[model samples]
Target: MTSLTLVVFSLLAGLLLWQFYRLTVACRRANRVDWGRGWMNLLDGLNRLFCYRYHRLNVLGMRLPKQGPAIVVANHVSGLDPMLLLASARRPLRFIIAREEYQRYGLNWLFRAIGCIPVDREKKPEQALREALRCLRNGEVVALFPHGKIHLDSDPPRRIKAGAIRLSQITGAPIVPHHISGVRGEGGVISGVLLRSHARIKSTSPIYPEEWGREQLQALVQAVLDNKSEDLESIAN
Candidate 1:
């Protein structure tokens, strides 16, 4: 081969190897708190890299405690939101997803591999909630998109589901409010990449559920959502 061609091939090979090394380090860091789900960190690393490249994901307030169970509640926009959160989190996160989405053809294995708990929205969502609570009690993080499903019609102000708050009330797990924006698309990977938007994750201080009623929990959520709405609006304009 020509000298120029040989040089180009060597450069490409070295770059690929460097990326693989970085991915390995990232996986190890994320797996520190993973509850026997380190394998999923490989996928999360890849997804996070994709978001960093295409979506410009900026995560804030992610300094979670080293130990203990906590509930992560976020506004769901696209399917990618979960992956984005997983990518940004320091611990392995168990997502409570809709059963239909969980059982999507050819993707069920992927969901199961990540230890996602599926909820039958039509019938027994309570079962899923119970499972999530159990996970929290066992000192694992449970992530819930309290909107119940992806809401792409508009920005914030959408009603927050009470399941997350209810879980916290039962388990005394701190609820971490996560508000995201700029996760554009119809929950499709290709569309999200093509959109090339700047996504942001705004996480607030953990709200302990100790001695707090459902009404109080709901009020805190509303206040957080209102603030997110204003932040999103300012970004748009």
Candidate 2:
């Protein structure tokens, strides 16, 4: 190549790199992500891009404490649900996921890095609970889907599990509920991530365990997840 051509090519590459760096910084700032790891921060940027740009995810009234122990509960719809939550959260969330999903081929390492606690439903599930308790004790955020599995909004009525309520009662961490909708690939994991969606995440105010009984709290969470609550207002940051 000629010297002038080489110089022009180098300048164009430099400009592209500079633009990419700016974009990454903007993404991290928008997502409130500072994972203390370059690779993780990069992954967070990619996640923001996928959720915000690719899926067109519209997050409404979702805000968590700047620094504290909290439990985030959402309806399990598609595999993309976690991504939506993570993108909306200001703090790092340690997810309580199913063991089988956590152990998925090629994704286990990523899951572990993100502090995912795996529970075997048929086996000793309390093991995961203990781990989550420990995280909350350390003032970390733990997120889980109370419905246990992917139960769509149109499916038959199913009761949510009591783990989130119990955790809130034990740790004094408020339970933040969110409802997800508009996922194109509603059931499959890979498909959920790959397909384009006009996703919407509706977040409600945190439910403090001191305000209600166990059964009542469970019912409230279910109502919020089912989008049946009348006073589901978004909490202000």
Candidate 3:
């Protein structure tokens, strides 16, 4: 099938899966279900079909905390990063998406099926942070893009927003640095010579308790971006 056909099929399949999850499978009834993990199994088939070839590197260190819950704070490189993580992470992950994106009827059900949490960028920031803490306290892994918005650059990433750091302090959940390396583009045709641009991702061996500070988060992300830049530069030369 053509790319358009594949995209249409994927959307239809996603919608049907979302409905199945809500009516017979979406997380519901506290203690009745793992709530955080209920929909993952249902989406396995769709993920295989739709998600492009993605490579995960250095995942050996990624792990579930033995005691409670934690946040997976990562750099945002592409729109497909969420699906890549969902297919790879053994634990169910809840994502923090903007409230406007969540309210749109077309996406709400599909996102809900995957257990994403919505934040109102225009409203109370503290309220969004609190909701994040609540999810962590309940033993759920939460994913947040610290960049807040996309920054296309070869330099170190833009300053990460404060919410991920503040939540680290509030919940004491270690901020595991998730780095998505090697994704880039703007005007190039989606097909063509971009073969090398396939997504390459890795989660740092979880940044430690004392290391969850904002400066620490910035340093870790910068280092990862630098390493990625060097690799690309070497390939060019």
Candidate 4:
């Protein structure tokens, strides 16, 4: 590995290993799962160590509702997006992850400790929907990359999957669109997806965050894409 990767790798492994052991012990006193805020606190420190800038964007003048199980729809740019969001997440979040990353070495164990839901891509998507909704029902932030896969050609007007819409409809949870723009890097090859750039997370349009019905949710996503004007497509092209 390169020097930077080595440094980051060693740091992460050391922190994760240390934190994992400590949390395992601490969690023994708790119930089945350890959903304590302690993990969040540790993650926040990790963010600082990694120089993660946690900025809340209010482009559309959006304010997150003080509640639970909200759908955090974010643009997929890098593997680091989850870490950044989780570390900077104001409240505890339960992530919806693809089978591969969810099953990756170290990540799976870590995700479990931090409360992430692993999904089988080959399985029926309805199952993923259920898991996401269930997390929501439990009053946890459910994160999803509406763009599905990473933006190989994430030009403006990003093309997002319909899953976020589907979940919002089912749970009546407001779909919070959090846009992540890549700054530097040759896609995922160089380093961080969010290597360096301005990041914006906005949840405008609703206060109590009413869930959009099936038809409405689809239209809402379409409108977002429409307004974005396929910006990623153009840039990537």
Candidate 5:
């Protein structure tokens, strides 16, 4: 090989190595970001910019308690639901995502940067739940989709999970019921990039899980979602 060719290859290798090191450092810093620090504040600003500009997302009645930890339970419409909710929320949300998604090859760094907690659905989901509960107890906002999967159309108001409610009951954290509409896409990252889908998310006042039984809580969440969906539909029509 010519001496100049070797020099060019060495420069390219150095650049790649530098980029990898930066990614590694970012992942570690994301994991250790202090809860009450400004790091999350910066991220929240960036999130809002992305959602508002790219998806034309709108938020409504999104007031969470100013004092303590709260859990946001929303119906999943598409993969973009989390980003929509995160951007709309007043504070940074620590999302409880599936372990499989967290370990994705190229996007793992992004997930870690957002401080997402991964749940292993195949083996032990309880461990993930416990970690989420711990974060709640420490007064950090946690967000999750109780529908478990994307609920297209009206299939969501009926299908719900009790995990968010259970966590609220244990931690005495209020459950903020959020109903989202207009986030339908072909699904996945590439789909979001190619298809432009706007989002409309609405939130109800916090519901205290400790005050209600499991069934009652579930019914309340269902009612809130049904009502919110109706309002959004009427507006859209």
Candidate 6:
């Protein structure tokens, strides 16, 4: 009886190890950004699972350049917005987040590790802009919610901040606009992730800063985010 029990235990352990190995491979394959750490890679995989499985995120017409710097601007609805963008992206993104959100308890370390640039809106906002410029100069992608905060469609109309357009003009990086919709928790941070919803990310063509005036660019970005642009397309699942 003892011998039989030992054999069963060994078999179970082997099976568990095999499954773990498979999971590791899958994570590695799905991870586009080389986080350079095993734990981060695992986290990235888990994020992908959360967005694709739990939230059922559908990415449509999203195209990023294979290399060089670019600015990704998305509409802010829920905290899940960033995760949805990250999961759909094929490159690492340095997010320009609010200072308070960047300093969130227990998440500050992760935010720093992911290269988030924190802006103190009331004080020294240019500090974050400088950092964003540095990242772009280094050929890194910088992402931001031009809306500045979590603004819902049902709320009063608000103009998007001009920082993203300014960044594009200065860095000469094309701005890629994406609109997020169908989030279950529209305003809550944790609730946005915890709740299940059929989320969709619709991306439009890249807007070149050199081709349009600042005002025009801002209006174009707003149209894309509002889903009022006629160029939006969806990819087949």
TM-scores of the candidates are: 0.77, 0.85, 0.66, 0.66, 0.74, 0.86
lDDT of 6 by residue, 9-49 (tens): 99999999999998887777766667778778777887887
- Enumerate residue pairs that collide in model 6: none
- Where's the lowest-lDDT run of ten residues in candidate 1? 228-237
lDDT, model 3, position 211: 49
Clashes by residue pair, model 1 = none
lDDT of 2 by residue, 1-237 (tens): 999999999999999999999988876665557888877987887787789888999855366877889999999888899999988887888999889989999999999999899999899999999999999999999999999888999999999988999899999999999999999999877788889999999887788889877877787788889987563332111
- Tens digits of per-residue lDDT, candidate 3, 1-237, equal 999999999999999998977644322321121334545444553453333432322234355565567777766655655655664565667889888877877879878786678887777766667778889889778888777765444545476676766776667777666566555432232321233345555655555546445665555545443345564344334
Q: Over the stretch 105-191, how does candidate 1's per-residue lDDT look in tens digits?
A: 999999888789999988987899788978988998888877766665454457778888888888888888777777767566457
Record all residue pairs in model 3 with backbone atoms less than 3 Å apart, i.e. clashing. 21-26
For model 5, residues 1-237, the per-residue Cα lDDT tens digits are 999999999999999999977755544443322336465544555556567777788745366787689988887766777777766666667899989889999989878877799999999999898889889888889988887876655552455788888888888899898877766473454565446667787777898876677877777776565555565444334
lDDT of each: 0.74, 0.87, 0.60, 0.58, 0.74, 0.86
Off by over 4 Å in 4: 1-40, 48-62, 152-158, 193-213, 222-237
Best by TM-score: 6
Q: Which of candidates 1 and 6 reaches a greater TM-score?
A: 6
Ranking by TM-score: 6, 2, 1, 5, 3, 4
Instruction: Give the 10-residue window scoring lowest on summed lDDT in candidate 4.
Output: 54-63
What order do candidates take by lDDT, descending?
2, 6, 1, 5, 3, 4
